[model samples]
Every structure is written in C-alpha cells, then in structure tokens.
Target: MSLAIVDAREWQNLLDLRTGKKVKDDDPRVQAPQTATLRDVLRRHPYPGDSDPRSNRWVTDSALDLVAAYEPQLACVVYGHQYFAGRYTPMTDVQRKGMMEELFAEIDRFVARSGYEPVVVGTGDMVPLEGEIDLGKLEGLAISSHWSARYAGLHRATPRDLDHVRSLAKVERVVGRDEWLAAFPDAEAVPARVPEHLLLAEEGWTFVTTGTPMRRPVRVPGRGFRIPLSTRLGAAPSLLDIRGLVLSGAAAGKKVALIVAEGVGMNDFLLPFTPCANQTGWHYYEPGDGFYLTLSTGRHQVFAYPSGYNYLDETDEKKDLPFSGYFLDFPAHALGDDFPGKSVAAGNHSMFVHMVFGADVCMECFARNLYNQGGFGVIHRFR
Candidate 1:
C-alpha cells in the first residue's frame, strides 16, 4: 500500500516558498504533470538512468509511499533537492533557508499524520544534533545520490601517490590520479612506470618509478594547482562489475552476500557503497566507532557493522591501513553459477555486476566526490 500522496502542485508551492519566486514553465524546477506509481517512476528514472531527479516528474506522493513502505520504522526524513526539486543547480542563501523551513514544516505535518516521529534533515543545513539525535541510529537512506551509472567512474590512487598528492593540498580529498600527476608533471614518469595493480587500461602505457625509499622526488612547481581536483576521473575503473545477491533472504534468515570490491571507505558502514554515505555518513560516527547497515524483510532483521579498518588517512594515528577484508556471520554470497548474471534488478535500478578472477584486482580505489551525484542502492529480497 502507498504511504502518502505527493502532488506536483504541492512541490511547486514548496519551491515557491523556498525561492520566493513564481516558478515559470521555463524554470528548471518546473516539471510537467504526469502522475504514476513509485515503482513506475523508479523504472522510468532509474538510478544511473536519469541524470536529474527532478526531471522525473514523479517525485510525488508515490515516491514517498514507496520509501515508507520499504522502511516502515523510518524515524528520520532527509529532504533535499531530491525531495523537493533536484540538486546541482544554483540557489541563493535566502532560497536555501526558505527551503529548509519548508522541508521542516512538511516533515512535521508528515509526522503528525503518520505518527512517525522522524527527524527532518535539510541536505543544505545538516548540523550536529548533540545528545538529542543520532543520524547513525536512523537508517541512512537517501535518493539524492542515486546517480546514473553513465557518470560513475572508479578512481585509482596508491598509498604513496595519494599521500604525495594530498600533501600538495589542504582538502581532505583529491579529484583523481591524472589531476595529481598533471599538477605535478614531474611525478609522471617519462617512461610512465606504475605498479601493475595501479595500471589503468586507458593510459595504454606504463612507467616504473625506482628508488629504495619508494619516493621519486620531482621538481615542485612554485605554486601548487589551487583548483580542487576533479572528483570524476576518466581513467578510473568502472563499478559495473560489482554485484549484490540475497544469499539468505531477510525473511528466511539474515541477508548475506559475498561482496567483491576494490576498497572500503574508513568511515563507510554499508557495503555496495553509495556516494552520499561517504559524504554524510562519516559525520554520524566518532573516531573509532564505525557505521552500520540494518537489513529487514518484515519478519527478521540483521545488522552489518564495520569489523575491519582499511584506507589511507594521514591524520589517523595508525599510518598503514590494512588491505580490505571482511568476514561476518551474515556473510556475502560468492559469485558462481547461481550468481544472477551481469546485472541485478532492484526497484528501478539495474545494477550491473562484474566478476574479477585470478590475481588481477584493485586494492586502492578512489573515494568519489559529491559532484558525480549519482549512485545506486539495492534491497535484495529473497523468497
């Protein structure tokens, strides 16, 4: 059953309230009216399918109902352009404040009607909730980062290279390997010798860096490239091979599946990672305690917490992080004949799964930025 009714007219009013300007037909916020079910909406505008969430014209009551049905115990509602219009467009400070107020009021109304006391979060104005609330306690679900796979790319960075690149900038993250090498041309070997594991297919050529310290000192530019690196890299690997399976259904047993991926974010709690989780989920935990992913199928519930730490962080007390390895009572199913083909259909998203055999593996994968703005989530429901 559907949970709530979402009318485009209501959305238009919210946008109007936030922007304090009448939305004209030409306005990007203005979308045509075409009512449909949440499933249909998702099917038409699947993650990595539609570039703009607002363009779907189906972010109405049906979408909310779908989410509410999937997670009935949901106690928090994070409203953003995904909820109201779409993200990536520009907005003024006044508009942002107005949008936050509108979202809060709408969430309050939803709570009153549904009897679900959900914490309302404005993507633009996320503040620490002290002792009153813990976002981690709330299921980290969001549609904002459900980006199309077309824009997705796997960034690669080795431990030493990443450190050298990050040292050149004050920001916590860099764009990709090329940008780092581009800014520091000397870092790029004339012959281009890179570790076998780090070699990318697109680059075509590879160069080896020699020396005992493993440090190839190059002439530093007088001024570092001040521009933040592009979060999107052309030569990065593709996540299309990553797959999800329901080894044990939430109904029969706790959901379990074998996940084969290149790396895991230090602050990331959930597997089959999402960009939004990386961007916002980190704030939910303290230094030591990692994040959590709770799964349910109306009859049973299972929780997956981070049991291992892997990633290169300069500020971290421990310098060398371990290679990614995870084992759990609720384990990930191995990819085999039973493995569901190259792609698994989830809601409206068609997640493509790739299998890596033998020794060729990616150990150091880049953590993507919010700019890609596209990601996919899967809820494996087994009978």
Candidate 2:
C-alpha cells in the first residue's frame, strides 16, 4: 500500500487493498477526488502505460513539495520517494543531485515554517507495518549504507541516487541491517541503518521495516485476509540460486521466465504450472539489508539517498567513489548481465529487470522531468 498520498484518489488504493472491491469516485470511503489532487504532478513521459502509475514512475516529489509549500498549521514533511518504485526510469548524476536538492529544500522550507520534524526514510520502516507481513524487533549495532549507481535515469520516479539525503540533517544513527531475522537470531547483530529523516520507530509504531531496514511480523494498518509473507523461509534459497537455475534452463534451450509474484509466498503459491521445487522461498536479508542489489548481485546493497547509487554496492561500474565496488565487472556474479540467451525485461518495478538485472530488450515508459505526458516511449533493445 502507498504509505504517503496527496489526493483522495491515491487514498482509494488503501481502501481497495483492504476491501478487495472497486471504490467509486463518489464512494464515501474515498474522499479525495481529482478535484482534491493536492498538486498536478504533470506527467512527463508519454506512453499508453504512462497514465497508470503502476506501470510508470509518477512524479511523487511534486506532491511532497506542494504539501511543504502549503505550510499548514499542523503538518509533518517526511521525505522518502525511494520505496516501491512499482515502475521507474533511472536518473543521471546531475538529475539525481538536482532533484535531491529540491526534495531537501522542500523539507527545509517546511521545517523552517512549522518547526516540525522532517522525516526522511527507506522501505524498511513500512514493510512490517504494511499489514501483509508482521516483523518483530531484533537486536543490532552501528548504521550501514546501500545506495548505488545511475541508470538510464529516464523513466523511474524513485531517487536515482541518495547522495544528498544525509546532507539534510545532523547525523545520529549509523547504518546496519534489519528487524525481521528474529527467527534467525543473527539479524539483531546486524546494525540498523535508519536515516535521519525517519522517526517512526521513535514514535512507537512497533518499528516494522524500513527503506531503512526489515524485520518482525508487525502490521502496518492491520493484517489482510489473503495476503501474507513466508516468515517460515524453510530451506530458503538465495535469489542467486534462482539465477543459476535460470542460466541452466536457458542453456538447455528452454524458454525461461522468472515471475516474481509479490506478497505471495511459497506456502501460498498454488499456481497451475509446477515449479522446480514443490515449495521454494527466499528471504531478502541474505548478505545484508537491501533489495534490487540483492537480486542482481547476491551481496549487501542499497540505493543512494544515503547512496547516490554509490557506497556498498558492487554495481557501481565507476569505482571512482571510495565505497563503490565492481562486482558487475564479472557478469556471472550479477543475474541478467551474462545470460547466455535472449533476456527481455519489462516490468512495473523500477530498476530491477532492466538496470539491476541486465536485459536485451528493455521496455519502460519514458521518464522525463517532474511530470510528462504525450506519446513517447523508452524502450532499449540491446542485442
């Protein structure tokens, strides 16, 4: 579910996800209408899917900026756009740094006017609270880092790099890992990398997961009926293992497709097609706390806010940064980079199949300025 929203339309999903029913414009449940849109984040990219946010990156910062500009009598400016980029385009260094400045400026302006806390964060903070999975707390130490690299920087709405995120405030907590591995016993030892802007844990929301970290079985609003995550990751397989399987299958001249059905666990997997194993699952915090990085390269990774797409990831091809690595150098280590056969990546989730996992035919909506609309497409065919 989208944690933050400006217009009433965005709120409908929250209601729909809960009830599994269509919410009408006049539906009392959905109070926000097009007329209620806080700010018109003019779409920049033009494509069939461009209008639908699920298939493209929506200029989310514009909403936050408008709210900050409103300077309401009572309002909090918590900046975080890096989570659940259902679909997106990468950003270049110039684009990322400039927009990041705009994001921080909005927060700074709001704080100066209202004197309220500026909350910025990662996906970890919301995962547990999402109501789908429950994440209990574990122990931990110092802070950690994950952000890395710049891609086509075209179609995604998530921050391409988090380089400027840390500069916005007085540092406190350092980087580490998450709260979910309570079942493992070792997760608590990993440091928690809560960024300065995030304060949900301090507010006592039972500290779920974060763009900051992941853990426990706590719910966001409340648990749903059919959706659930497999905390019982029995013989959990690292995604890297799946990568190997795909390669082997492809080599055998078999048409391979890796379908990642979100929210559905191995226990809940009841698809008609039989998979390699009867029940197979993998946990996210394999090497450390991260997402796409863990998928492309089976190592600890994070995006740049705290990253600017640099720091701890092996994907940063330009090892110019002190912290970045060159694991992508060895195509075999990364998933799609070295696929022996034709690999095509087309998905709503940003930066994954296309950027993180290299693709031959990458199709995504054109991502331009703050917002865009017309009839332009961003499709890359790298044969």
Candidate 3:
C-alpha cells in the first residue's frame, strides 16, 4: 500500500507560476494528452538518480553548486558527455574502472594542496572499492548519480544498491527517486534552467515532517510533491562566535555531523562532542541559566545570560565570555524566499535526525545554531 502524494504536473505548474512562463493548461506539446501524473514526474525525476537528458544540462551545474555550498572543503569532477554515456556504450567494465581510478587520483591531487579529501560523484552504477579510503585524513567527500543514469533505456542504479555503496563509504544519504521509471506526453521540453531557477527563486513550498514513519504523508496520484528538507531554517540561538577558536591541529581530530529535523534545512544543528568531562557531551542547564563548559582537564567554566535570558550580549554585565570547548554557527544562507512571504508551493514533508559525535573541541557556536533551528531533541554519541 504505497501512497501517491505528489504529482509531476505540479512541477510544471509551479515552474510556470514562479517563472511567469505561460505553459498551456493541458498543453499537448508538454506531453499532456495522456495526462502525465506526479508519479510519472517522480519517475522521470527520480531521487538520487541522474537527471533526464533534457534536464541534465542545467541540473549538473545546480548539483555541483549544491555540493559546493555545504562541503566547501571537498572538491569534485563531472565526467561522461551526455550523448556518449549509458550502459550500451562500448566501454568495458575494466576500462570504466580505470577511468574512475584516474579521475579519483586527479581529485586527490586537487585536495592535496589544501589537505582535504575528495570524493568522486558519478552518474550510474555503484561500484564498491575493495579497500577503504582514510576519510578522516581527507577534508571531506561526496558522490552522486550522473545524468545518464536517468535514461529510459539505459542501465541505471537502484536506491537499495546505492544505499549499500553509501554504507561502505560511511555516507548516510543519497539523493534519489521515490518511484519507478515513468513515461510522459511529448510537449515543449522543460528548459534546463527551470528547476534550478525554481529552487533559487524559492517559488515552491517547503514542508517539515517529524517523528513520522518513512514514506508517510502520501500524495494524491496526480499532484506534484515538495522537496522535504531534513531540518528547518529558523534563527538559531546566539552564542560565542567560533571564528577565533583556531584549533592548531589538522581537522582530522575535529569531527562534525548533521542533526536534522524532517523537512528542515541542512544546517539545522551540528554538534561535536567529547567525553573528557562526563563521558557524555550533552550540556544540561535550567531555563535562564548559563551553560558551563567542561574541559578535557576536568575544569569547569561558566557563562552568563543576557537580560533577555539569551546568551550573553552587549548589555550583559558579565565582561568575561566563557569559552565552551565546542562551537556552533548557522549556515550562511537560507533557501531564500520566492517573492517575499509567498509560501513555496511544494508537496512533501521534512525528515529529522540528530548528529552524534565521539570527540570534542570548541563548538559553542555550532551547537547553538543547531539548537536554534529546532531544539536539540536527541543526543547520541555513536551510530
């Protein structure tokens, strides 16, 4: 009993409304005669899968940009021309493996100067490497599906298989499709820039879902669905600025993970912990009370509250700012608004999860940002 909640036509309708591009109602050219539904749209625009040929041109740029926005420390490469890709290509499995190896080495060199790690994102097929890559030694990593993976007649990777590959790489998520492959009426092709502009324009709706079963909030068969973020974008609690902590060692010892609330923004909460003090990094305090910093040396430090019961600000008499070994900071940008206060006409719910770490350092600002997005509801130190 799968639920069909969002419709693909909604994608076109929302695109038209946001861009002011007039798409005909039931226009046969956009493939309307057969009445393509949201499920059909979803199939075509599968999650984690590469975009269709028509949609690939713009999506690649958007996808690369999206990865860069979050993982600034990581680098990438875009391979395979649109026309020459797909399983039917004359390339052999060994030849493809060699191609990937060469590409991976190039990314390694790019990050070598910066002392960061690079992960290769590809379009189709999830190949597992027999050896493990020392991710901690590298800055960060990312891999994704290629556009050719979405072709109607090509061999594409499945989410289940992708999930397995992610586990091998210790990655938790993969952007992928929600349903099977679909077909639609032939009409004016959706411009490559449409989806990118819609997201950037903030014309669609954003939904938040919490503590619900996976795949709930089923959509109506024909309506389009919304892009459900894992966390929210509300203003976070103010805390000590983290820009100055300036840890001298490599980030190899510094750890960070995502703590997301269903349908919320990505930076909802980032908590790095250490058990040097209480064997648990969870900070507990009463309302209006200041949070103490417990150092690895067993020393206790205190922070004072501002007049408004928030973190210490200018008006507070406490001249000393207690340095919490951990720091917190909000993401620099929100999805932004379409035209100001207009609800993004989206059709899905959000997903939520908390970040748990095993080590700790100065992370006050980082923790505060997470708590501000949506109070840190859960804390776990291990996966």
Candidate 4:
C-alpha cells in the first residue's frame, strides 16, 4: 500500500515557503522590477530569500521532487483558507481570492507536466471563478465549511465541527466517516480542524500519556537511570501545553500528525532540524541555546526535547523555558556501545526531528499553524 501525508497551511504561506521569496513588499528582491514569472523568481531564490537558508521557507521544490522520485503514490495536499477569522494581513478577501486562484493555476499546470500531484484543497467560497479553473477536478478534496463558520469565527470549533463540515461537503464517502469517527475521540476540542478526507491515517504510533504526567521516568541510553518526561506545575511548563500525550510506535514507512500552537518557535539548537522530510508550514525556532538528545539503533531512532513554550509576541524574553539540563547534563556519548560505528549528536533545546532510514523507509512529520487549545497526533498502520 502507498503512504500519504496531508498537511494544512494558508495558501499564501505555502507559496512563500515553496518559492523561498516572499511576494510581499518588504522583500527587497520582490521590489526589484522584472518581468520574470513566479516560476523564475522561485528558481533564482530556491531557498528562503534570506541570509539564513533554514528560515521559514526551507522546504524547496527540489526536496519534494526528490521524495516524488521515490514514493510514486505520494500526495501533498495543501489546504487553502484562513485558520482563524481575522484580517491577518492588509489584503482584502477579494485580493486574497485572486492571488490564490493565480497560484493554484500555476501549480495545476506544473503538476500536469511533472506527474507528481500536489492536491489543492480549498473551501467552496475560496474556489476560483467558474471559467477560471476547476480545482475540484484535480486530485484533491474541496469541502465547504460554511456550516461550521459560526464556530470558526469564535475560534471555538472542535473536531466534531470539522466532521460536520466534511459531511456537508458530500465527501464523507471519500473520507470514510465511520473510520474517522472511530479513530479519534471527540473528547477535547481544538481551535481549527483539518478535514478528515484530506488526511490519511498514520499507522504504528500509539498514545501512552495524555495531559502531562507527573514525575514518571523513562530510560535514556547511557543514562543508566530514568528521567521524568516533565516536572513543571501540572507536569507542564506553559498554558499553551496541550494535553501532552506520549505516542510510542515504530516509525517505519509511516506519517505522523503534528498540530502545534502557532506562535511557538524553536531555539537555535532546533533550527537545523526544521523543514523535516514531508513537512509543511513555518518551521520556526526560538532564539537561544537549548539541547535535544537522540539515539538510534539501526531502523529505530529515539529522541526527546524538553517541553517548552515560545510566544510570538514575546520573542525576546525567555519565559517558561523547559529545563533541558535534565537531559543534556550528561557528557556527549557515542552510540558505539549500542550500535557500533554509529554517532549521535548532542543538542540543547526543543526541536522535532524525523530520521529517514532509506528509500522505502522514510518518516513523515507535519505541523499546522493554529491556536493552541489542544492537539494530538495518531499513527495508524495500513490494514
């Protein structure tokens, strides 16, 4: 069976990331008068159009091309719509719609010639004009969330709200309604919900803990002891900390769901780990030194970062930083004893990483930019 990973991000955000050069006026490169097409601009600044290549737009088109060359059935679904109801930018709804249409058309043509289809999922209201382009005809699922707009407007929508939206869109059959409802419980609600039709189940990973657990310990290689997952109040360091759940499973040929709070940023130690394989959205990091410890035994890799919070507004001050000394206190150790000739890097700070074993044994990770009420990642194996 083929593996699929679906990620949701604002249409403009996706374009900016893929192109590496923001189309905004603030970008000096964007201001340079030229008749070059968007494609040309992207080709020139293949990485984020900045001094730092690992900035927000680190996932270049070439990376996707590489993945496609290996996984023929892979589909990267890009959802177009505002995660929250607000004037996020100076652009009006009409302007936003026009921009989306143009970008979508360019992508459609590119995919037609490339054979690797990146589905463009959008709402009915966001759909292009009748004669412009029929995005629905493409390998994508277009759903109308009009019924759930009321809840979305208040930023209080739940997974159930999204389920209702999918039902209204008439794509429930494509999404397999019964299976979705059965997979995740509607116990806690989140700010935004990506339609189930767009996402495929992540197999193997299982939830071990929900809502931070107290001083429970887990063994770390070479530590010769166990350490708590967390030790802050309520076993969490910040209010943004959603019900922390430990998902344990093999990462063999599977995709893992990631829905992190929008404002959180990774520190310097985490920067190198951004733009993970098959990942989308802004791979941001907080500015400072932090550490992460990792160990790999052939096909199996294990790593952990201290749970911390980084608010967008207060990027300067370090508040509620998860104490990383607990894990980094040990001297740098090589993995030779456990796995001869293997080397493990020592890091300081919170960051997410995905290790690709080989062509057929790659791992997928995704993070969506949305409000942080609560979130969970489930990995389901193919039947």
Candidate 5:
C-alpha cells in the first residue's frame, strides 16, 4: 500500500527519541521507514467525504478518494472499496430499491471480464450471538456510552459461515459488513484497526447498524432538512438500505446485522472475494508517508482540517488542526454554534459530535464511534 502512493507521500525524517539523535532512513532499526509513526506523508491526509473534501465532505472525501485510488493496488481483492469499482458499465442513478439489481448485474459483468465466477451470496445482517466478551471490564478501560464495545474492545464469535444471512440473501454469502475499511491512498495511512458492527441482541432479537442510527432527522428537503450522504453521518448508512433492515428486523421481532470474527485475516476474506494484488515486483516506487484517516463522519469540519484525529480526543495532541480548548471560553460564534435558543444534535458518534458542533443538546450512540450498545442514547443537554 505504501509503494502504491509513493509519489504523494512526504517521507518523515527519523529521530532517536531517547538519545535525541537523527535516525537515518537506512538505519537497521527502521523496520518500516514509512510506518504510521514515521510517515508524515500519510498522517496529514483526510478521510473520504464530499466533493468539498473537508472533514465531512472535504476532509473525509479526500481520504476516501486516496484509498479508492491506492488500496486496489494493494490487493485486487479490494478491487476498490465501493462495488462501483471495476465496473464494466457506467452507473445510472436509480431509486434505492433498484440499486441491488443494478449493482449485482454490474458485479456479474466484472466477473465475466475477469475470468472469475460470481459467488452471488444471499445474506442478511441478522445473526444470533451465543456469547459476548467485554474489553472495558477485562482491560480496565472506561467504555464510551455512545459505543462502548469499540473502546471496550468487545468481542463476539460469529459463525464461520453465516447460514442465516445466506439464507436471506439467498444465493450464498452475507450482503455487507457494517464497518468498512479505510482507503485513503494519498493521505497518511492513519492506523485504525477496526470496529465491530454495532449490534444489540437479546431474547432472540438482534439489531445491527453501521451509521448514525439514533434520534435524528436525516432528510426532508422540502422541509429544509437535507443531510448529504457525503458527510460521515450521511455517507455510511446511505450506502446500504438500512431502513429495510430495521423494518425487517422490527417486523420479524428479530434484527439483522453483519457478523464478524476478531483476529481474522485477509486470507479468510479471500474465500469469497478477489485477492489483493501483489505489487511488490509489479511496481517500483519509493519514499512517501502512508496516511491514516477515518473518512466516515462529519458535514464540513473535516475539510476544515487536514486529518480526522481532531475529532477524537481534545486532550490528544492536536496535529495540523488547532487546539480544541474545551475549557477555554468558546467564542459565541464557533463553527457549528446555532440558535441561542436551545439546539440539539444526535447521532451514533461520541466525543466528535459534541466537540465539533457545540450543540446545546448532544445525543449520541455507537459509543465513541466504537461501540454499538443499543436501546438508548447518550443525551447531553444544557440546563
């Protein structure tokens, strides 16, 4: 992946922390000179978002576009993060319901062109959890109320084969996984391991989600509410027919969610998908940082900054962006300050929403953008 975007990266000069000495690029201790730590090239790039390329649209999209451009080179299996990649035909905008038919058909075309057979797996998001593990308690960490499982490093065992999703999707494999991978090809490859698909199941019922699935209005253009799917909040859930899943789950008294296993590697993913390309001998490029950015949230602030780390922890060392200064007296006119009359923002993200928007009432879930605990929301309303 580093080699794929070599031209765009800004290779970092090395330094020995303890001795305060400069480390040469060829130093034996430098296992990965372009690692996330050393790769100043990757750290500054943003995530996928809108055309504007800020945090939501601008910041996130730049990061995502980086991935779409480079990750495919890392592995043909990635074949581009969106199904649209490797498409033999151009996509025509259609209603949401027609999307699958259009997608599957194009996927079939790519298969035919590539000399590969289509796995056409019919899958659902619903699966039962036989047991659970809490990283918060085990690791002695504080769980984010919005999405505790993420910080807690919660773990669960999903069936190696999702017979349930296949039974529903009908042909063979599960449809989608809630959490998607980062694909910023140009941005510094910010290292984000992975987060679980937000799910809550009890008494034979389960609800799994991948976007801001809490109390909020997503759309109604005529009424003056329009959330662009380009922003992290809008972009993610917009990718899938989450409404159908929620409705189906509600009707059946059972919910559907993508299932996964931890410590699983790419070899397992290769079972149904194309293998990532081997570009070592295939390509010859040198020296640039691999950026890491989370391209999944925000409306505009992302573009306002070069990377997404600003939204995570205020106390965390602020990179390219300015200090959050949470306790400092915020000017009445910070970026997202709205009506003097109480304003509210609710979604699945945790610290980010409160930090960026400064809303009077900030409600969240998907605890800290990591956990998926359900049946509630974390509401922060000013008295």
Candidate 6:
C-alpha cells in the first residue's frame, strides 16, 4: 500500500505543548523549519519534471499551474487534518458542506485523470460536519470514521452508522474472512456496507476502508474523560442516487482549486471541478438552493475591499499574485455586513482577498505600481 502522510510533522508542530494550544496564523511557535520534513517524504516518491532523487523536494509550481508535474503514476492519495487543515468551525453548517463538497469535487477530477481514487479517511478529529443527512428511506447506512486503518495511531470506528448507510445504499454481500483478502487484496476491510469480495469486480484497482463498529470518543475541553458519540456526522450517507449528487458539481465551467506548498514537501493538488474562486478568491458558496446552485446564506465582508488587479500590468515578476488567501474572521451579525438579512447566521465578519494571477488583470504590472506606491497587498481590484 502506498501511504503518504500529509502534514504529519506540521500536525505535531501545532500540537506541541510548548506552542499555544491553538493553531492559527500569526502564531510564531509553530513556525519551526518544515522544508526538511516535506523533503524527507517526497524522497520516497518518484520525482517528475527535472527528476533528481538526490534533491529531496520538488519544485514550487509558483501558482500550482504546472501539469505533468509528478513522475509516479501511483494513486495520488491525500491525507488532511480534520479540525485544522479541513478548516471547520462549530457555527457554520454551510461552510462544512462547502468544505466536503469542495473536497469531493477535487478528488473526482484526480480520480478521472490519474485512474486512482482519492481516499478520505479520518484524522482523529470528531468534529461534526454541521449538516444533516436524511437516511430514513435508505435500507441501511455505513460510516467509516478513520482514513487508512494502518496509518492511524488511535483506532477509531463507527459500525452502527455504517449499517445505516448500508441500508440506505442497499448494499448486499459481506465477504467472508476466508476469501476476503484474496478477493480484494488491495481493498481494506471496512466494517460497514458490502464485504471485501462483494465490492471487487473481476479486475480494477481497489481501495480498502475499515471502521471500528464503535462510536468515536470525544473529550470536552477541561473535562475529565472522553465520551462516545452516537455516529460520525461527517460521514456522508451513501444513497441510491448518490453517484448523481456526487458528480453533479463536476459538470463544467468550475474553476479548479490548485493547492501549493511553497517549502512543505506535500504534493500539490491540481483540482478541476472544484469550487470557483470567490470574487476575491476566499470564500466558496453553494450557487443556489439546489446542490450546485446554492449560494451562501451570508456573503463575506472582505469582498467589499478593493481587490488588486496585478494582471493589468505587463512587466513585473517579483510579486506573487494571490490565488487565494485565508479568512480574517467568521461572519458576524453586526452592522456594515452584506449577507442576506434573512439568514439566521451572522454576516461574514471578514475575508482574505487573493489577487488574480497571470495575464487576466495584468496584475503583474499593477502589483509593481502598488508596491512602488507603498500600497502593496491592499485589496484594490474591486474598486
């Protein structure tokens, strides 16, 4: 099994006690050297572009625009931390849906191009997705809590939820122990849904997933012991038309999300069919009430800031255009907000404005002017 641990050291870095417990931007404690850690992992993989195994890390894609970048044809598996990396908050259900929707859309493209499916297992965090799934009509449902079983230090599982999903998916056939590995050698035995042999066809690369038939345990801060949750809320229920709902967003015209790690050795993701960049390249909202058309219940305030149009310029090369930035604050209900008033949730408090890259706005030239005027990094494109 090709196992790639993403942000393992970074996770450790953030969790380190010496640092403040919370991981956030502007925190200097977690800023230890990460390049070395990234390079060490990439060394094991085949390097593409100007291949040289001796050089531990791969080249930065600038904006993650390069293709034919990776050398290995292996399945490009991505592992991410749920609480921090996944960027979830307790208050927003829309953002939670958007996050997974974005992830699924990104993975679908990778699967189509690379012929390898992206596996999304758990990363020990039991933060619910903040959304609801209707499973009353389904025959059963199965939920897998952790990512790859072998890679998890703390064993976590959810069997009852798995059975619910199985009922909903109408899954039949549980592979017996004797023929399980032989039939589906590559597939991990998931305690939910169909058995190993039942899932595999005569030939096809298989992905194995397993979950403990137990509720995930969660610890309340300042509390003494961990409590078992009924089910993993993040686990999406498999439905009859599940394929249709899953693939609808991948239809077309969607701007691909390109994730790049400058010094970190984690592989960059060239995700097409992912959500388009926000007006300022920060927030992604559902287009409409329908799966694809749903927009956010509230709009972000940062979009009101003037976005920089560097693509308007013709010559400067030193400045980096923002493909996307981070959120300054979650939406707040106070005045000076633009989100729909009907929304019970507060308006977006603030957002990170990412400048457009390449020749789109001639931003390269614009950035030089902005920097010369000592106005660099100020949102200005909207104006």
TM-score of each: 0.28, 0.35, 0.19, 0.24, 0.22, 0.20
Q: What would the per-residue lDDT of candidate 1 be over residues 1-383, giving only the tens digit for each residue?
A: 00111122213121231112333556432332211222233333323322233312222232244434433222112222222122233456565455434433444444445543221111111111111100111121101011210011122334664454345322223334344234334221322211111111111111121111122112111110010111111111112112121322212332222221111121211212223221221112111111112111111011122111111111243222111112111223322223322212111111121111100110111112222222222122211
Candidate 1 accuracy as lDDT: 0.22
Q: After superposition, how far is residue 276 of candidate 2 from its true place, in Å?
A: 12
Residue 184 in candidate 6 has what lDDT? 29
Which residue window of length 10 is worst by lDDT in model 6?
342-351
**Residue-by-residue lDDT tens digits, candidate 2, 222-302:** 111122112111222444344444555555554444433322222323322222221111222211123444444544343
lDDT of 5 by residue, 1-383 (tens): 00111112223333432232455657544444323321322334422211111212221222233223222111011111111111112334343224333333433433333332122212111112222222122222212222111111112314432333223321211112122122223322223322232122222221222222242211100110111111111112321232222223334432111111111123212233322111112110000000000111112111122211122343444232121222222223322243223333322222333333343332222121223232111112222
Per-candidate count of clashing residue pairs (backbone under 3 Å): 19, 65, 63, 14, 68, 51
Q: How accurate is candidate 5 locally (lDDT)?
A: 0.23
Q: Which candidate's TM-score is highest?
A: 2
Lowest lDDT block of 10, candidate 4:
342-351
The 0-to-1 C-alpha lDDT of every candidate, in the order given, reads 0.22, 0.29, 0.20, 0.22, 0.23, 0.21
lDDT string, candidate 3, 276-373, tens digits: 11111112211111111111111221221211111112223323211111122111111111011110011010110111111110010111211211
Ranking 5 against 6 by lDDT, winner: 5
Off by over 4 Å in 5: 4-94, 120-383
Error of 2 at 201 (Å): 6.3
Which portions of model 1 show Cα errors greater than 4 Å? Answer: 1-60, 63-78, 82-87, 121-163, 172-383
Q: Rank the candidates by TM-score, best first.
A: 2, 1, 4, 5, 6, 3
The segments of candidate 6 whose C-alpha lies over 4 angstroms from its true place after superposition are: 1-67, 85-88, 117-120, 123-125, 128-383
